[model samples]
Target: MTQIAQQHANMDETLMLEYGKGNDTAFAELYARHKGPMYRYICRQLGSKQHNKAQELFQEVWVRVIDNRNNYTVEAKFTTWLYRIAHNLLIDEHRKNQVRGEHLTLVSDEQDEGILAFHQGKQEGSVHNDFLQQAIKHCVELLMPQQREAFLLRHEAGFDPSQVCEIVGAKPETVKTRLRYAMSQLRDCLQRKVGATEVGGEREI
Candidate 1:
């Protein structure tokens, strides 16, 4: 990595440490740096059907961060710690849904721009690409919750498998199996939608 980018990447831990020491400005900086991706993560987790609840949960995640500042440690990357909190909150939400007998599914309200950009760069024909996006989203919603979480943490949050294991509190092999199953399901579903080999028309997951 470039020296400048490396320095910026390291700032998250530094900012959180400062915040632990009660530096409000440091806390603000940390929030601003992370809020966008983190909020989107929550929104995608709940899907558009529960956007209002997603907003509440998003705020709660930050509130927990603020509440726990003094207890923060530098043992891991700040993003890892932050996402671990989110993972736990999502688990609570799933349990609540189960108790209420609500069918739980994770669908994106909109196509992820990152995924779209990737397809755009690699494929021609917008119409086919759009269909592919919708197919992928549909298949994702059908993933089992454990598999879906592992998939999103790896793809959406750009976390490596080890970091995903940490966030989800799963063994390395468990997380890997989840990811493998998710990819297989998505690929199989997409192939059924667009015909054989089309899953690779843009790029492999």
Candidate 2:
């Protein structure tokens, strides 16, 4: 394994042990490491409609994580377990809200443009990068829930296909298929939007 992976493995064990012992710092460390990815996952799942709700749900997930720390086991990867909790929480939230299907709207006008500009600068150097970014987000929004979830887990969250399978409760082949379709759709949509601009530039999906 790479050094970062080794370190994360070691840290997971240590932090869990410390959390079991009621060490706040360890729990904090775990939260700090995971909060961004968890939040992003939730945001993507909810799309723009549930920004405040997703934040509230994200906090609730952390609370549950802390409350249930004593029951944590190291059999699976720490992230696998963490994401399982997140997945369950999301399901519960969805059930509570009776949320189904995808909604496409610009819910947050807050810094999306700035973030998109920065990301575009790093990826495509075109002047129309913001338009392209918005188009990509819209295209992603157009995906089926499972395809979007699988795509985000694989590409955005940096999970392997196997780990995504574990998190999504799908077979590895199923995860691969979802990812393949997601990418193909994204490529087609983006090509239509940006007119053959290189997708993702340095970041090979």
lDDT (C-alpha, whole model) for all candidates: 0.80, 0.74
RMSD of each: 6.6, 6.6
TM-score of 1: 0.77
Off by over 4 Å in 2: 95-127, 195-205
Report the lDDT tens digits of candidate 1 across residue range 137-167: 7677768889988998888877889989999
CA error at residue 128 for candidate 1, angstroms: 3.5
| Number of backbone collisions per candidate | 0, 0
User: Which pairs of residues clash in candidate 1, taking residues 3 or more apart in a chain or in different chains?
Assistant: none
Candidate 1 Cα errors over 4 Å, as ranges: 1-9, 106-127, 195-205
- Residue 18 shift from truth in candidate 1, angstroms: 1.9
For candidate 2, the TM-score is: 0.77
Task: For each candidate, give its TM-score against the true structure.
Answer: 0.77, 0.77
